[model samples]
Target chain A: MSELLSITATGLTKRFGDVTAVNDLSLNIHCGEIYGFLGLNGAGKTTTIRMLLGMIRPNTGSVSLFGIKVQPSQSSIWQRVGYMVETPHAYPDLTVRENLEITRRLRQMSATDAVEKIIGELGLMPYANRRARTLSLGNAQRLGLAKALIHHPDLLLLDEPANALDPAGIVEIRNLLRGLAENSGVTIFISSHILSEVARLATRIGIVHEGRLLKELNANELAEQEEQRLAVDVNDTVAALSALGKAGIAARLDGKNSLIITDKPTMQHPDKVATLLVEAGCPPTRLVVEQRDLESYFLGLVGMKEEKKQ
Target chain B: MIASVKAPDNIISKLVPALWVELKKVQRSKTLWMTALAFSLLIIISGLFMYILKDPEQARRLGILGAKAQIFGGSANWPSFFNLVLLMVSLGGLIIFGFIFVWIFGREFGDKTVYDILSLPTPRVTVVIAKIITAAYWSLALILLVFVLMLGLGAMLQLPEWSAATVWNGLGLLLGTGSLTVLICIPFGLVASFTRGYLPAVGCIFLVIILGQVISQLGNGQYFPWTIPMLYSGAAEALIGKVTAPLGLISYILVGLVGAISLVFTCGWWRYADQT
Candidate 1:
């Protein structure tokens, strides 16, 4: 209920007949923080976003925005919150400028030039006069973002906002969202399946799998927890294993015929492992330190790797 | 710091902007032009039928006339022409006006844009009301277009039996029938919202039309909300009894009641039901 907490949901659950879309979920997002909601398709990410936006009511529990309970009849709370639930959609026949203009009027912004300003900010000026149906998917996503940001809301909830964007467009949106949070104190709750995208932008990240939040971590903590390993290529595998074992370093051979050392000591000092291997008369052919990427880390966190194994 | 300005917390303050947005959307939709063209074509075809009926014997010699003139059912004059206009409004207005309501509400779901409008500074009820207002306004515009064309075409063909009183009475009947037809079509907005698409709403319209005809044949047309307008326009009085007997206060109340109930349901759905 604190004012500083822009979003608070407690025991939120939604059921569609027999299927539970969101189950016993609770989370808090503070102001000026970009909270990345990472989940696979149908992991209840969009459902949770819908609940937050009051598009769908929870079967149980509650959601409060800016310390006020969210309800469909409550209009004042929405003035400070902007959201794009799933895929961004606009009236296909309307031009980009006209679509943004509609949002401006509906948001009740007195500024007549708000549409033009958003167009320029989202780099949509080139296609401002073009019909939405005629734009490519990437441009359509930009128009959707433009509509959500037109009023410069204090809170933004975007669901898979970078769905159809190209690489550069994704980076552009990431920078835009990051800037909004840092410069304007906008609290953002963005959901995406792309771990690298969220890892790069989110101040705090929540991973949801199977209608449950598995873990929550800061960006720096996620970075520090990324798996690092010392890989060694030696002439003789038996001699290298014996040498590393004699040195009290646990080492195992990976599937690709390379010795993999994931223990903290050897991973911290690959040079020491190389010396041990050379002194044992097994000259090292390749000694390298490799870190696991965000995708692998995310897949591991969500138990997707275990599922894949089964 | 990002300055936050709260929207005024009143229905009137919310309605203006919501109505503006609804008007803009309607202006840009192709459905508006499509409906206008369909209605215009019906008026022009009715005028053409009247022109052909003016002189059947000479027209028979010209090979342009055929058994189609029999369908006119009466002499080619201002009275019959106005009656034809009334018939068209009562019959065709059901589909055309129903289509306007369907597009105004169904297009939000069809285009998958309902979520965008659900969580805005304007209340969801305001959005629903705005759509209803837009549908009514658009239906009225199309009705006016049909009336103007009927007048101009009647003049050009120079049909006989023209008088100021006839024109006034005919205009009044046509406007009354059009309003009644529009009123009944409001429920389709609820159907569209419930079905969440255009095809289902269109199916509902056709089903209502068929049921209205069947009910009228059963001699109970006056009591049916869909058939009351047709009966009031004298479309079904030949088969049924006097229009006034069946179309009592209860009948008008039924039509208004259907509209009121449908508006309540549509607004309630928008405000309470889940968008998914």
Candidate 2:
């Protein structure tokens, strides 16, 4: 494993009696890149992260982080890894300054860089003296983010890190995560329901559903999965259907006048369809182009698993 | 020219940071200040009545030591008023400590913060030990602080000289009383780590305390109260020159060993535990 591959695990499996939470999962995350681990509830995202952290052992598999084996006897890799699971609570009783102080002490972060510098970078000075319990969720998250960044660890594992945050808070955290990955060369593996936000921040994305990794694709790959669904407004529905059939293009009528065409939105495909429609009696006009949504893309990827179960 | 330095290892040190973070919860939540205020008031109120208005003059002097001894304990010098107040200090924060401890260890699941804890590089056992250690540290510190406060009160009242044996006995009770908290807490900490809520962990605490109170009552109170504060240590009885271990040393060892071993086993499942 290279330094770029901050964490690597293969054939990982965890069983609870008869139930298998994670099954032979294998993954390698690179340094200075944000990898989004997308999954629904109980989709083994948490289970996999736990194995990576060595909090739980896989029944049959091995894990190494930063080139070091993840065994109970070895924890040097942990010193260089930072993680925030679920909704992190800063010491509610401790003031912001005190919380940071404790985090600094825990991470043993005494060197040229200090807690004061990180504290300032996190913009926590205003509420530095107030108890953590009194801070807003956004502020508490900032404090959590501050704690994660205190030691400047090379690897960060976050699970639904932005859950329950307002839009602004989400954007702030998104910006912060991007900045960390871009400027400091930190490797982050994060999981969240917000796939588009994940797309905005993650360099690469892995979609896991039903304890299995469906696919791992980059932002560009997701964007490249473009499909065209057009709204065709026609006067006579029968005539429109007849014309669309003649063109060998598939389309369904929306209500009575509008027909939706499902096809690739390439210029050539749309142009060919337009030529075929104009040749017919009902010439199509007011065609609208729609991009594939995350939900649609995700459903196209993993929704079939649920359907199979049904 | 500088020497190349090697990075430090040993994950145990990470516990300090994570535990420090856990301890800070008390201060951030206002529960610490709230507990201290409530404890201070309880001391000033009930203690003033118990010590000052209750003919403490007789309790303080060697003149009435015989009568006071009958009432407090058999020839134990009526627990110098300060020590009496200090013993009662534990009672004041018992509820608060129970709540805080449950929150620290179990409430992560209750309030969903366990995810934050397990996701970190810190071990599950370290998290468990840190909460217990934090609670134990605070309990011991507050008890000692109250003892000092009572010492000041004793001076103001001009109480008679307290014996070295009484002081040592008081110290033993003070340490021993809180030590019982460790035995009491670890089992609950295990349950807290194993179970899913603050209520069940808290329910276990009450069960232990209630059982201890009932057992102490059934055993003629004073004789066994000090004896079983964590175990049947003759340390308190030894303070007054009484010899012979109250319970077999092996019994004491067994109680600690069984509790420690059970706690560790519960931690074994933790290797499979997720962020929560």
Candidate 3:
């Protein structure tokens, strides 16, 4: 199991003076798996990535890449791991090609044309000669991804990879990362505050809140866990409530002249709800069985966690 | 297939690529040209001083310009010109060389690109060494430029005492003093790393320059690393009138030791310190 995992972090905890940045976080991302590390700002996502890259030492526990211990002295491990933490930065004075060339040389990549190849692949050929400082925010993010993917490492850790990107660029990056994972079997541990973005790309999602992993689930499990509610509007709201009460059904008015039903049977059977409301002399005007989105689900989890703390 | 990078058995293999990257960055920056232009101005001013000394009567007839030239009071000859060049390099080297070191090390953090190189196949220590080597190369190149420009001005002015012995001695002193000053500026790299920016390291350079003057005045310059280059340049003897003793081997050893320790600390900070 350990051999099959590309990243294994056990009981990782990091504290900065009086503040505990990350607390008892553990994760195991398998090879070729796209793991979405979902967290809001200051949720220790960057801190955890730093620990995984051996950039910062954890107060307790350890991290390993390819089953080898992660330490600054373990220079060999970095060759297989590529990462971009936070907003990616490039040498502002150097051109896009020159910046990539420096990365190639420092990476000891013998292929001389690797810079051009990455540029073409990242659709940066038009801006190849332009200085990094002159490139737009989206182009800069592309350049960052290009540098990370230039060497094609097996494990790529990216923090907020879609930051400062337009909708088209975000989709381009999403497809690029998905292709890398699906075709090349690259294990990607991507951190982002955008849950919808991760929902569309990640196979497994881990929600981190207040320096702890609040939840971890696969796409299907996440969908199954989404809270479902049946919403119905009728001509007579008071009579609809009376009908539901007489029929021994749990329902309430949502303060907007609509009845909200959260019971599993009622939500699974909206037709029965409509028939019940219709027979009570209150015809249904509108009906909807709404499933909670990943964003609200994420916020709800965080809100619940905060509520527990309070 | 992912290509594997071999671990370096020696420093040279690791240093080559890192050095290449550092040199490319330095080559593309405007700071190099700005520093070069400043050196050219220094040489031109020295030439103007020599022009004034060549004819004291004509200089005095020019009013305030003549009086200001008198403050430079040395004879308009190759020996004096050589001493002037050495004096400029010795003091100027601290500001210029220290500036180069601070910028090379601090710009990464300043520009927020430090994270890019932190996790590469090349060791962080190799990168630190490469930056130091680049700073030294830049400082020496500036000194060489000053030496050649001074020679041109002296030849054009047709000053006397233009012997091979004087030129060679001047060349040796400029190179030696510049080299020592470059060596002394190594700690600023550590300072840049510690402060994580160029502004603080620039402040450190000014502090070192002022302290160098104060400690050299206190007559304990031979023991201070920062003051050794100034004293060895023979400038302190002329300017301060107190530093008369010739620099011994101990002074050279102290400079070398301080430089070596600073290099180690810079590398250690890169290797072990949490670059947050």
TM-score to true structure, per model: 0.92, 0.75, 0.93
Q: Over the stretch B44-73, how does candidate 2's per-residue lDDT look in tens digits? A: 643453343346465566445435333432
lDDT of 3 by residue, B16-65 (tens): 99999999999999999999998888888888888888988878888898
Q: lDDT per residue, candidate 2, A1-310, as tens digits? A: 4666887888888888888888778888888889999987888988788788777778899998888888865644566877876677865556788867765654545453456777788888899899877998888877877877777778888888887678988888889889888998889999887677788899999998877788999888878765546666767778878877866667786675777776554333666666666777677765556554676678678774211110
Interface RMSD, candidates in the order listed = 1.8, 5.3, 1.7
Best by TM-score: 3
* Fnat for candidate 1 (0 to 1): 0.68
Q: Which residue pairs show backbone clashes in model 1? A: none
The ten-residue window of minimal lDDT in model 1 chain A covers: A301-310
Q: DockQ of candidates 1 onward, in order? A: 0.62, 0.25, 0.62
Model 2 DockQ reads: 0.25
Question: After superposing candidate 3, which stretches have Cα over 4 Å from the reference?
Answer: A232-246, A252-259, A268-288, A304-310, B4-9, B238-242
- Residue pairs clashing in model 2 are A56-B271, A56-B272, A92-B28, A92-B29, A93-B25, A93-B27, A93-B28, A93-B29, A94-B28, A106-B17
Kindly report which residue stretches of model 1 are placed more than 4 angstroms away from their true locations once superposed: A231-247, A251-260, A268-288, A306-310, B1-6, B62-65, B236-245
Q: What's the TM for model 1?
A: 0.92
